[model samples]
Target: MEWAALLLLALALCALLYLLGRWLLGLDGDLTLLWAEWRGKRPENELPDKVVWVTGASSGIGEELAYQLAKIGALVVLSARRENELERVKQKCLEISNLSSKDILVLPLDLTDRSSHEAATKTVLQHFGRIDVLVNNGGRSQRSLFVDTKVEVYAAIMELNYLGTVSLTKHVLNHMVQREKGKIVTMSSVMGIMGAPLATGYCASKHALQGFFNSLRPELGEYPEIIITTICPGPVQSKIIHNVFTEDLSKSLDNTGDQSHKMPTDRCVRLTLVSMVNDLKEAWISDHPYLAVCYLWQYAPTWAWWLMNKMGKIRIQNFKSGVDADISYSQKKKA
Candidate 1:
């Protein structure tokens, strides 16, 4: 009887110590990453010669992803609205990799144009026969208060960011479903997981993506070979800030914030690829302390709300001062 009592006491003490360690030592993140690694939940298949279709490949993370994938021997399909920029990216990819121009198809795509998705898919399949992965990395950003923003702005963002991505995925998904093996990778933002100031439409679109993909995951359970990965990155150094939409749905060209502190685009893409290779269902790729905010939002809702409210007020003040008010997008330029 004494031994049994002692054993119970020891177990209780261990549990208490673990909880303390998780809180005071902040070992939760490391422990979680370790567990994921131990489970071997990441994709183990090598990427050589695999056909990867990347949207928004003209610049930023998508462009970097294409170059890296090509270096690893993946046949990359580069897509965006600018054919010239796509060609430039293709050439750069070719220069760095052993792939020929024939291996990299420069496919011009406008995400808002739903009518073009069918032909786009057909063209991809005609060239590569099959798509092993589809990376949906194209979308716009918002930088206006919900009250000041036009209704059309919301629709425009939803059309391009949500519906357009969904439409393209639908076209490609049919082929993936038939093949019984494929990957769907998307670039959602930290805003998707938590709301932020001057990002009502943007947040809504990302949140919608989260819902759509999460619901779609269970339906694809029959096809164990198919994997869906959602990457949520926080404040990466990219042209996204330059392309933010305003109240009138106009592009803001004025840059704001300290981008030097943000994660480099190359590093962001590298982390995203690592998550993809691991076959993570959802992952946050950020160099900043944004992961802590994600955790707080998830576990301590009231605290997150209070923090966001404070941040939102600061953002509003910045906007009013015209410090970061010029966040907008223009036509794609040749890289």
Candidate 2:
């Protein structure tokens, strides 16, 4: 009995050490991933002096990204639907520093409009003479039940999130390729990898982003100078929830406002910038590195994440499927 107890204790210690090594130390596979990153060797900063266009720069992550890039002397072009809001954000950026005033350019656009993207690109080139980076970050969330969703809702979400991003990138790719240098930063969500309830359309769009960016990365590598990056983050404490579409296909969404009070917006955008400048292929952000662990355990036969998600509030069982099922539908019609 004494010998058995000692063996069990030793086994437990070994298990704990293994877990600690993998978790805290990050000694998992793909050390080559970090090695692949450009890291300290940035290319004499083609980033700052050249034009960098940011989508959805009116608020939240986009707004913060614009300001941060501006601070770095990046000639940042801001785009979004809300002209007034974008103006306010641009003004605030200018107020923060004079570097931003000369570098920041506000050009409001609805990503759903393909022509707008082309026009925006033209404007950027006309204004700054060259486009060096494109940040595709403008996206909305759907908080409706899948069953009650209208086809329009799904179409709209896909049009804006997937098609819009691809269209803009496609428009500017020729120039970037000709220049033989550029960076494409795509913003995906944690929900992109892990499907959350009541977000079928949103999830599909984000997953599409991952697939599209991943495939394009290799092609861009042909240039060896153009870098492609995809970012995945769990919910951040932002106004994104307020903008999420509900069942009624309503723009004014207040029902599913994510009040979880999680990560700060500044920190989130800053990390995204760091990841971008470092030329990282991918980065996953969350309170914990659960997303990285998910990547490690993704190949397991059983869908352990599905089982684990089902047990947590993150799964959101009460979520309705289609737009009609969401409370925002009726609320919007009433308004």
Candidate 3:
């Protein structure tokens, strides 16, 4: 009887210590080691002629990425819905590179259309011969509540975010696998790590992407030089805030939110570029509230992430801002 009582007391003490340890980690859980390890493993840069495709390049982070890659001498193909915007970006990149305008190709593509991916790839192949890196950074975002959202809204989000990426990836995977060399860098939001209350469809789509890529990451290792990288960052300073879909199931067409508090698009693009060059599997850009929520919900238990994500009212109100205000698609948020 005495032994049993002692064992129970010891178990309670151990449980208490375990909870205390977890609380301590929660208080100071920094990923400096992970960052250092990733920094140490960056691969050498590819040559100038390596064909790299940047989708959603009409504006935002995609344009930034295209510009950065051009500076590094990589042949770039920029795609988006707006050819005019794409042309502006291409011209800027050429000026930056001191290279001929022939080096950059502008292909406008609607990501929601799965059939469009093959045609776009064919154009890239015709112009550049073959692509060495494909950056899938095109997609729409949402700011609707799960309870208030229509069923079709979910489907549309999936079609654009998840299926759209998969379709494009499928189109390129065969060629990349055959050549045994390619880089597939996906732009998924930090919301991919944890769903927020009012951003149901966006979160779901991003989460699905994380699952798909994580499962496929190891499978791609069979190809000697193929690299698959997924990037997740907090709210980036961009037109995405103005692009929030409304509670009435309507997408906003004007900018009406606080864009000042968001992270700079250039910084996000540079980080993404460095991650890709380094062959990182995953990256999370640091920021305020959202960054904290990313961890509190991801490593936390089931209900923990849920409760933490719900601690906000900004999601619904952002819906009033016009999604159309994005002027160009957001490659960072689209990631």
Candidate 4:
């Protein structure tokens, strides 16, 4: 009887541990961000009636973000280089949400145009009276070997992804500092956390963002309510591949491989809102393998390097063969 009771207890413990491990593996985001999604302040509760300025609002994650924010009752300012696309996103937002035409502002912006950022900030503030949140989502990615790519391509990537973001943030941060309260959420990537092949420039840009925001957070110690949040999302289904800078600035990616396997855009934006509301200093939003690698990168970097070496080879081969670097490896596993 004693032996049977002990055996049952051991089995129960093992079962519990197995389930816990499974749950962790299934998670699409870091523990902190997911915890905020599950139990922390909800976006609906926190974001309603707030003014949110989202850059890169013409497509991809930015477009999806506009739709979600509309549903949540947040007043949104949509900006990108293309006015026509911004209008289309605004119209969709109007159709889906209760917000009227005046509630959604379509301001055309070119992030690379640093001269216009100050005036852009004023325009948002003039219409809204105050800027409550700034979503620095404007940026491009790269897909080329460092040796093959021109120095100009690297300069352009930094100009748009790093310097452009910083320029906009500078203008907005001045306002946030004056108000002494708001959220500045920048859409970084898992690429920011780890280095990989075919994206040397992209990784460097994101690293710059990570270092910038991480350092900026400390500088704003005087204003506790002014939250600086960095969102590092892994591959979510988007048109990012179509826009990636290749070996030369004049060229574009010919094959944007299967994005079907990536995490859904809506899911990523939803968690981003959660991180914003909860005031998380930094959040990692991504699905497995990448998410797991983020942990290895942070805690056990030597092991992370070993794993990346194995994975990087596969990524380079996929790029060379004109297949989606991310999908080919996973699809092979599924096969």
The models' CA-based lDDT, in order, is: 0.81, 0.72, 0.74, 0.92
Residue 262's lDDT in candidate 1: 58
Write one digit per residue (lDDT tens) for candidate 4, span 42-122. 888889999999999999999999999999999999999999999999999999999999999999999999999999999
Expressed as tens digits, the lDDT of each residue in 1-335 for candidate 1 is: 99999999999999999998556433212233435555644332467788999999998888899989988888999999999999899999989999988899999999999999999999999999999999999998888888888899999999999999999999999999999999999999888999888889999999999999999999999999899999888777787777778889555645465455556788677667666767778887653245666877999999988877766776677777765421221011122
lDDT of 4: 0.92
Candidates sorted on TM-score, descending? 4, 1, 2, 3
Clashing pairs in 3: 187-335, 188-335, 242-322, 243-323, 252-322, 252-323, 253-322, 254-322
| Candidate 1: Cα lDDT at 47 | 78
Candidate 3 structure quality by residue, lDDT tens digits, 1-335: 99999999999999999998665433211263246335554322544677888888877778888888888788888988889999999889988895678888988888888888898888888998898999989877776567766887888788888998999999888889888989999999888987666677888899999999999888876785989989887767755555555455465534454455556888787677767777778887645455556666767756665655344433543444433222122223332
**Which ranges of candidate 3 are over 4 A from the true structure?**
1-47, 248-250, 253-255, 302-310, 313-335
Ranking by lDDT: 4, 1, 3, 2
Task: Specify the poorest-scoring 10-residue window by lDDT in model 4.
Answer: 326-335
lDDT of 2: 0.72
Which wins on lDDT, candidate 2 or candidate 3?
A: 3
